[model samples]
Target: MNKIEIIARRILGWKLNRWDRWYDFEKEQFIPVSEFQPEENIEHAMLIVERLKELGFSYKTNGTSGACFGDVCETGETLAQAITNAAYSVADNSSIDEGWL
Candidate 1:
């Protein structure tokens, strides 16, 4: 399977996902927005958000690195949701794409 890891753009508490066949992805409390430097300011974060948007992510904007969209994401929400949304946006392959987890 393809094991991939991308730094997060926001802080996430975590949740259990049992919809598809993908393995469980670890829950990270903090995720870096930029792929380059681990630390980031709002601008760098926005840049990461913009890149993520191009990759399939979306956001309304709240002057933050990552915007809240799905289910409010738990107070601060999750940075992974944006990418997950983008991934699912491509297609609903949850039932088959076991590697998505």
Candidate 2:
């Protein structure tokens, strides 16, 4: 496996599956949120957020009442796009190439 896949599988504990789904490490099987715990889902999401931060991404909240979101440093990008770019960076060991943000 490439470094990206290795890091994703070993550190993030995720495996891409068909139908836009991912394997849940805690569950030991491939399934959707409908079969998982809410807390686990939050934990997994936080993991990605943390990783993105490590890759120089930033996040903000609406003063504890607004929705939480992330953005690229010095750029306006959606949280989802930031996360995807960061993951690709980790996998490829290269800087983010997406220009959306």
TM-score against native, each model: 0.31, 0.35
1-101 per-residue lDDT for model 2 (tens digits) = 64334445544566767544568666677755344221224344456557555656565543222223343221114443334344444444445453321
The collision pairs in model 1 are 8-31, 8-32
Which residue runs of candidate 1 sit more than 4 Å off their true CA positions? 1-5, 8-40, 64-66, 69-101
**Best-fitting candidate, scored by lDDT:** 2
Residues 65-97, model 1: lDDT tens digits: 334333222112333434333333333334434
Every model's Cα RMSD, please? 11.8, 8.7
The TM-score that candidate 1 achieves is 0.31
